[model samples]
Target chain A: MTKRAALTDLPLVLDRVSLSAGATTMLDRLNLAITPGAPTLVLGPNGAGKTSLLRVCMGLAAPSAGTVSWGGRTDRGLGRRAMLLQKPVMLRRSVAANVAYALAQAGCPRHRRAARTEELLDRVALLGLAARPARRLSSGEQQRVALARALAREPEILLLDEPTASLDPAATRHVEEIILMASQSGTKIVMASHDLGQVRRLAGDVVFLVRGRLCEHASVGDFFDRPSSAEAAAFIHGELVL
Target chain B: MSEGLDAWQLIASGDATLISIVRLSLTVTLGAVAVAAVVGLPLGALLALTRFPGRSALVVLVNGFMGLPPVVVGLTVYLLLSRSGPLGEFGLLFTPAAMVIAQALLVLPIIAALTRQTIEDLWREYRDELTAMGVGPTGRVATLLWDSRFSLITAMLAGFGRAAAEVGTVMIVGGNIDGFTRTMTTTIALETSKGDLPLAMGLGAILIGLILAINAAAWGLRLWSEQRVA
Candidate 1:
């Protein structure tokens, strides 16, 4: 597969986005900008609209009255965008077939599609299980397959909603390594995570959401050292501040 | 004992009339099921996905039709398609097409209703996943229906069993014309009323066999879908 050139130039900007379902609010006037090649971590407790903000940024959920602009253009299609959910959805096909399907949809050529899937399988270390039923894989294995499928698109922006949510320590490290490698390749990575260790390891910056509102948007070093909000301080102290 | 054994010989010897009746029964049942599936699957998906003002009323109507009285359906269709009734212009009465249409009406609701239930249940899981993947409207609906293909197949089989084994609608609408629309169910009905006990019994055995086959298929689909869910 001919890998598409990396998007090392464009910025993803979500300005004053608010998402509400019925009367209850998900995201409340969240404003932030995401620079390419920087892994941004979204940290928040439950019910904070962390996932909702990612959905808005990925163009999955529309903001009630705000703009999600990619490259300063609100109307630009998110064609080169890819998002992974907490519990990834896999096709009922083989592991390799799942990757191939995503690559094909991303406009990879016929000959390139298979080779891309093979390379992804190797990268995810699931080459031996290429033909095994994807649905039957363990949770960690399924998560990797989902990652491989997403990266096969060679997306300009990668949005992950708790990609390592339920994985064990080793599994978490493996996923973190993949994200790091993709970030190095100049594919912008945006992740929502609860694990502070993971946030520290991968995110160049942190965007914190608290109760559907933006509490902090700062560099990783500054965020962990001197969080501006009491909620972030309480959260860093490992106290539940919801 | 002698009469029953002799009827078995008739069934085994490839009796042209019996063979044709059985084949016709299969055709009408499968044709109705195919048509019902095409219409009912989309209706089911819509019912499960959309939230309109009349949603509950529509659900109630569909659930009511799932258990609709077969004889009432037969009577209404019989009147409409009969020689003196509303849709008699094209002269579709007492024909295989009439049977197909009546049976499709009966079966379509069952498939549609059950498919709606299946999709509604799966929606809770798929809604977030599809949204996060940025699946658009058309793609979202199509993948939901396709992913639950096994459940829909079970729904169609359930419809098939009801349509194929039914007697009232086909007899009334098709008139059970010999060599034209005479099917297994109607043959059994005719043979019984006319006091040909042995032939009716033979047809009854065959009809039961067909029912068992269709139900087994439905059960298989259920099991396969269950395995996936598990």
Candidate 2:
């Protein structure tokens, strides 16, 4: 069977997007564009709207105001993008089945599903535990399974929210490696993280946010070296941005 | 005393009449459950996943129907199938088919209401991930139903229990025709009315035992499957 057509040409643009829940704003007229390229890391303090931004970009949440478009089209580019929430909810099934579910959702042919599932499991080093229930796995292992599931979609754009937030150092390294491998394989990676070290190690560009508003968007090197905004500078220096 | 011993003896001997009644009971109730499940599960899943005008009212209506009186359902079906009634041409009244119809009507809301509750709870937990995966409406229903299978099995069992334990519906619709339409509950009611307490007690014991066994088997299956998949 042939692969689904890629959506790599579409650049995700958020034009003056604002999201509010009741009284509090989660995203404040945030204007940004995520073009096809290296991994872009979103850095922010607690409640900085990193998650909300990713949700809007993934088309999982509608912004209360303004518009989000992909390749100048306002449609959600379904099957072309996938997101791994901060805490992934595993299907009540085996590890292999979880990836297979994603594969099936991505419209993988019936005959190709098993092979594709196995390939995704192997990529995450979860082939040995293929028959194990996904929910019973360790948090780090579940995170990897979630990665494999996201990868199973062959998504052109993969969004992750703190994919390694609760993982140990070794597990974090493993996740980062898989992520970099996905990035190398032409998937545009947009990830949110709090770890500055991870940002330095994995990010090509940094989008910094403070209180639901964009503070800076620059190349990782420039953002880390020059530190444009006081909030970004203060954030990098390990000081409280608020 | 002697009566209790006779009831046990009747059960141990696998009395032909008793066995046939048990068989008919299983056939009608299981048939009713099958019919109800076919219609109710998808309807329940749809209610859980969709919203529209009067959806809440429909949900409330289905929930309220869960406690519908079996005698009332039996009377309604009787009227529907009685001679000179709209469906009289097919002649379903006072037959096992009539009993199945009445019991199905009695069980449908229980299964559907419980299934709606189960799928709704599961849907909440699965919403974001499924949406991100681009699963469509039908896919969402199928997923929620499959994942909530254990809970749904319990819902089905609840329906079965309701159908099996009630005598009024089957008694009215089946006419308690011995050697034909008689079921365990109907037979028990008939024997008791005729003062044949031993036979009634024996059938009562078997009915309770059968329900207990089914529930046990379902419980075990759910436990084993959950362990395998959890």
lDDT by residue (tens digit), candidate 2, B1-230: 12444667777787777778889999999999999999999999989989999999999999999999999999889899998789999999889999999999999999999999999999999999999988999899989999889899999999999999999989988899888899989878877887888767877988999999999999999999999887
Model 1 chain B is weakest, by summed lDDT over 10 consecutive residues, at B1-10
List native contact recovery per candidate, as a fraction of 1: 0.20, 0.80
Global Cα lDDT for candidate 2: 0.91
Q: Across residues A48-157, which tens digit of lDDT does each residue of candidate 2 receive? A: 99999999999999999999988777876574889998999999999999999999998889899999998999999999999998989999999999999899888888
Off by over 4 Å in 1: A1-10, A75-77, A109-112, B1-7, B12-14, B51-56, B83-89, B217-230
* CAPRI-style class, candidate 2: high
> lDDT tens string, model 1, B105-127?
99989999998998898777777
Listed per candidate, the RMSD to the true structure in angstroms reads 3.5, 1.9
Q: Per-candidate TM vs. native?
A: 0.88, 0.97
DockQ for each model? 0.27, 0.85
Q: After superposition, how far is residue A81 of candidate 2 from its true place, in Å?
A: 0.4
